[model samples]
Target: MNNNSTGGLPVAETCNERITSPTSNLGPQFTLVVLVLLAILMVLLALITVFGNGLVILAFLVNKNLRHRSNYFFLNLAISDFLVGAFCIPLYIPYILTGKWIFGRLLCKLWLVVDYLMCTASAFNIVLISYDRFVSVTKAVTYRIQQGITSNTIARMVSVWVFAFLLYAPAIIIWEHVAGCSIVPDGECYVEFYYTWYFLLCASVFEFFIPCISVAYFNMHIYWDIKKRKRNRLRSTVSISKRVSVPSKGNGQPSRVSFLLKKEIPSLDLETEDGLSTSSRTQTPPQVMDCSHLSTTSGNDRSAALKVKTRSKLHKDKQIAKSLAIIVSVFAICWAPYSLLMILRAACHGECVYEFLYEITFWLLWLNSSVNPFLYPLCHVRFRKAFMKILCPKRLAVLPPSSQSSLREPN
Candidate 1:
């Protein structure tokens, strides 16, 4: 459609108007002193995460007793933590110093991909652990009697990792890292989420909010189940003791002790002086009785042993559940800030309300990976023993140092 007849042909207006955003330039900004300190701290944390998780994995691998279907989740956790610390956290240092993501488009996408994927893995792993424990505690009686873990434990664990992957893979698959040098001298790469809002919403819900709520609910049920089992055990114990100690009147059954007493002790035949009765005078010499109570006492002993063994197993399972709770508690404390900020960022549609706040949360969330290794040994005696066997074998054979220190001054 050329308008050549008009002496002065009007030119088509080009759509070159720029759209501006207040936060377009807002990136990670930290003071020189703070940034240096933060970088050093992050370095240390990353090192700890790598090394600590390595030790955890090694300990699990080396110790045959630690090899259980549930502990496999910890191994998965170690790998996830290692990835977060090694790949995801190190990328932040450059961002903080330059106030821009300078790691290039490929790396920028990689960072976001690894960040969400592994973090989701970690979160959902905890959920898996909690649900597993809930199952264990709730089905304590059947579980102990069966003497085997349920068949679905492995399936549940696999499902957790799969869900984590599927939830965050879209973020990477739909990733459009727009790169431009004119945006800044150093160059800029952005994870554009405007077109992926629905994906982001679903990922956020499935990967975080729902999982957290479910974990908390499952842990509560586990706690109640443990308490209920404890009460039932106490009731059964009291009833057993009463049955053994109290005699049943007008019934055919006597008390356990009385039955044994009556069986073991025979009547003493006495001689009557000046009586001519042959039955009383030279009665059968007080015959030695065979141990008549042996069978009853042995049977009682076997039942007691069975009870003790069952109690020990339950106690061990409870301890394991408690140790897992400790891990989850620590994880919750460290991850809450990150998850909350992530929700805020998601709600804002990638328009974060504050600068540098998410970075702080990022640091907090990374702290969990570093802390998990230490929490295991501290909270669980089995892990403590395994660690000691791995690191301080000589010291483990020796008795632990007394809590009452002789070096302390008399108060």
Candidate 2:
């Protein structure tokens, strides 16, 4: 019996070593606590982003007033945020908490694919919004008449999904599993630094660099055009004023002015006097020289000027879309560090400088997921008004009380 027990001791020790080796001495208690706190933060951010973006989408769908080309793009963006929160955040929470992946190879591949695709789609959606804004503001009259939520917008959205799928395909095909200790014992999954790097590079180029450059270019052109238009308007006004103030040739009168101000000058009205009653031909005051008529003309001029100004404002809105593009660019910047770290880690074939940087980058990337909804409200008056209508029904009374209450309810 003693000899049998001695042999069993070696077998038990081997089992223990295999089970504990992966996570042995991984971190101190305080470090674990910090990680837990981070996990909580990620959860809260995900919730807020998901809910806020969902609200934006809901407002668009329910508000007939928001049924337009611009809102269509916003709908796509909101969908992307919803997918990230619903699918990616849940998978990631567990992974981050344990500092390892216990999900199966199939799940890992699937999650990675979805993550990349949704993120790519989201980035491209921003580009589309920027372009749409550019079109609307640059050509307000045409845009107001023609652009709306329609089959064309749906086709564009479909194309965005197709592009995202193509963008994310490589990650699933190329990634290989690495042996590591995960949250679950007896679980095996893959992790590699090269895959991370590849994701970062591709995402940065399409999502960050391209969008940023395009938005900036569009905004600069739009602003320049607006400035030129303002100058032209000023020149036109000066010309009109000069024409109005100039006195014409005289025969006891300014000849050129006589023809221009004929309706106002009493002597000029002599031709029509014989056709009218004596009371209708009463003498006019010099101080009131066609001022009523002039004011009416000026009012028309001002109305035309207002129309031009509204068109210019529409152009400025296109620049706002450019601003959204910049916001997407900022998201790429936030994500870049982690991606670079992952690539470096992979290149080294082990953890090195990337270890600390990776954690920081991870948090930053997570932050990007939470900020865009707030940005939309900040940059867009329409979105802000819509959001307000949805949030505070008393302010926008277009909707009935029941419908407004429903809108305010949590989803």
Candidate 3:
């Protein structure tokens, strides 16, 4: 088994007693089958992780509609996941199957650094996405106003990578030398401080616990904000319609209809001593008909247009919030088990948790990378259409350019 049960060199340590492969007890035939299956599964995960996130990056690059400020965070996430598939997963496959770190100490250190950096950056990007959605939901005006500013988005993206690197890179690099000895065996590679419960606690808190908490809090508020907005919008729309349609005491017609008529109707005829003034009626211009028609219809038209606009805007915001919530949820699910197990193992000095469980949960983290590509399309129609357009341009040729632009998410 690898040094870390959590899969990556960043994960929890597997003690000496449980270093044997899980398939050791099985018959040779069964073990071979299991190994073959595991190899294929891991390879597929690497491919999926690569292509899925790669597609996102590609789509973002080619599609101007997806160039919104908020999407830059997603782009950063895809870049991290892509690196995972491209570098981390591929490197780990050889060590995992062979049960030895033949890749050398230098490569192991590099792998540990790259793996932890990408994984931590992925978590940070998720936090940023959640925070962005929360702000867009609760403080939409401010978020929209700042949408045009590219520097802020760029800074946030850079900070995610920087903070992620700072979180674990220094410790991973200097822990062995600082401690005056390496905990890792000659044939395996893992963090030297796996036995340090304090370090694991701190790292886990920053890595999984804090990110998960922030995302949950933000998404909860987002849900509440969306619900409140929907309720308020419905109430306002109903009240406005009621006010517009309510019968007037004097005319028995809607007050708005009476008001429009009073304001728009022309005084074509004047009262003369005997009766109506015929000459004044004759001088009434033809534009009177057009003006009267416009006054009455324009009010209704404007009301309907405004209502549609408001509904569409709310729907778009809700979809975005929903998509972000799903992404955060997936991140939590993928990382939480491994993170908890890691902390538990660290606290117990690697005795309490089973090796197999750690291995299982470790793969679950990588599963997040593979699964993320599909989740966006499942939750977001815009991403789905954009992906479809990229994948099957001929099929979507019938769709007008206006339709594509209309589907663009609001910044």
Candidate 4:
């Protein structure tokens, strides 16, 4: 019995060494608490990611109002995030907790493939959404009419997935074979190319740099275009008011221009009359231009109504673009650290960068997936209503038509 007990001491000491090695930087109690907290946080994040994205998918399917061309990109994003929650994050939890790839080589390969494909798809979907918003806003007249046509939108969404797959799947699938030996060790699972500086730089460029640049450009233009449109609207309102306002021969009050009644200005909105009073307040007694005839003119009412409808459609498009901009901004924040660290990891082969920083950045990337569901509802009223109705149908009160903002594109 003594001999046996003495013999087991070495085995016990080896086990202790193995366990302590990974946590040498922190106290044993502190490490335990950190690991436990991480495990809990990760579990919560995974559940939220799945639930939130699932809600988005359900809302999109049920709410016909959300089936517009721009929103299809959102649906694509939700699907990718849903897959991340369902497969990628959950699969990674054990690896994170144990600090080993205990799930075996086959599962590791499968996890890596799905993880890269879905995440890259998610990034590409964001870029697509940004580009779509740009086109819709800058070319509102043409793209507005094409919103109902599904073919082009479908093709774009499909291409995002296909491109994402081509970018990462082929390399992940064949890297071991190409290298003629497995670079990943027996108990570890990571992309073998992380050690290759050139590939990392190229991947970072395609995945992070280009997308960031494109989003920034699109968003900047969208902002400028929106501002320009508003400025033009104000100027048109001012010019039309000036042209129509003439001094009455008797009371000195402004009288309507005869030509305005003789011909229809299709761009003229009834709202222009409201602006006339506001603009006149600074210079003279508030003179309300008589726009009653403008609404009653032959075919002018139809034209003005059409103009109002188009303007409203553009307004809704602006709102949607703003929401997507928030999404893109969030993505940049979450991804920037990880992307920079990846380049560092590649340049130094993990010598300069701390492992904890890499792990934090990894979690931050996943955090974006968790955050998007909340963001959609917060930024977009339509999505909020849909989510409320779905989650608490009985509790949801019917909204008046005036209160309900329809996100549908104009027919």
Using all chains and alpha carbons, the TM-scores for the candidates as numbered come to: 0.70, 0.68, 0.79, 0.78
Residue 307 deviation, candidate 3, in Å?
2.5
Please report, as a residue range, the 10-residue window in candidate 3 with the lowest summed lDDT. Answer: 267-276
Q: Which residue runs of candidate 2 sit more than 4 Å off their true CA positions?
A: 1-32, 173-203, 247-329, 335-352, 394-411
Cα error, residue 39 of model 3, in Å, equals: 0.6
TM-score winner between 1 and 3, please give it: 3
Write down the lDDT that model 1 would get. 0.58
Residue runs of model 1 more than 4 Å from their true location after superposition: 1-29, 140-157, 175-186, 194-199, 247-314, 349-352, 397-411
Assess the local accuracy of residue 83 in candidate 4 as a C-alpha lDDT between 0 and 100. Answer: 93
Candidate 2 residue lDDT tens string, 1-411:
112211111233232232221222333423767877867887887898788888888888777766666777778878887788878887877665564567776787688788777777877776777677666545544555566448888888888888888865564544322222222234433322222354545556765568667766666666665566556545544544554565444334444543344333222111111122112353456565543234335534543553454344535544565675566567558756765665565444333563446656756765665676666644666666677877886776876667555444110
Task: Please identify model 4 stretches exceeding 4 Å from their true place.
Answer: 1-30, 247-257, 260-264, 267-321, 397-411
Candidate 2, residue 319: CA error in Å? 7.0
Q: For each candidate in the order shown, give its overall lDDT on alpha carbons.
A: 0.58, 0.57, 0.72, 0.69
Model 2 superposed RMSD (Cα): 13.3
- TM match of model 3 to true structure: 0.79
Tens-digit lDDT string for candidate 4 (269-322): 322212122122222222553443432243344444434644665476578567
Evaluate candidate 4 by giving its C-alpha RMSD to the native, one decimal: 10.1
Best by lDDT: 3
lDDT of 1 by residue, 1-411 (tens): 111211111122311222222223444445668768867887898899888888878888898766665567677777788888788778766665565666686676678778778888888877776765566556543433433454555666677678887776664545322211111122444344422345455666776678777877876777776676567556644544443454434454544555443332222111111111223322334465333333445535533643564466456556766776675677777877766666566455345446367667767888877887776534545566677778987776675456213212100
Question: Candidate 3: what lDDT?
Answer: 0.72
Better of 3 and 4 by lDDT: 3
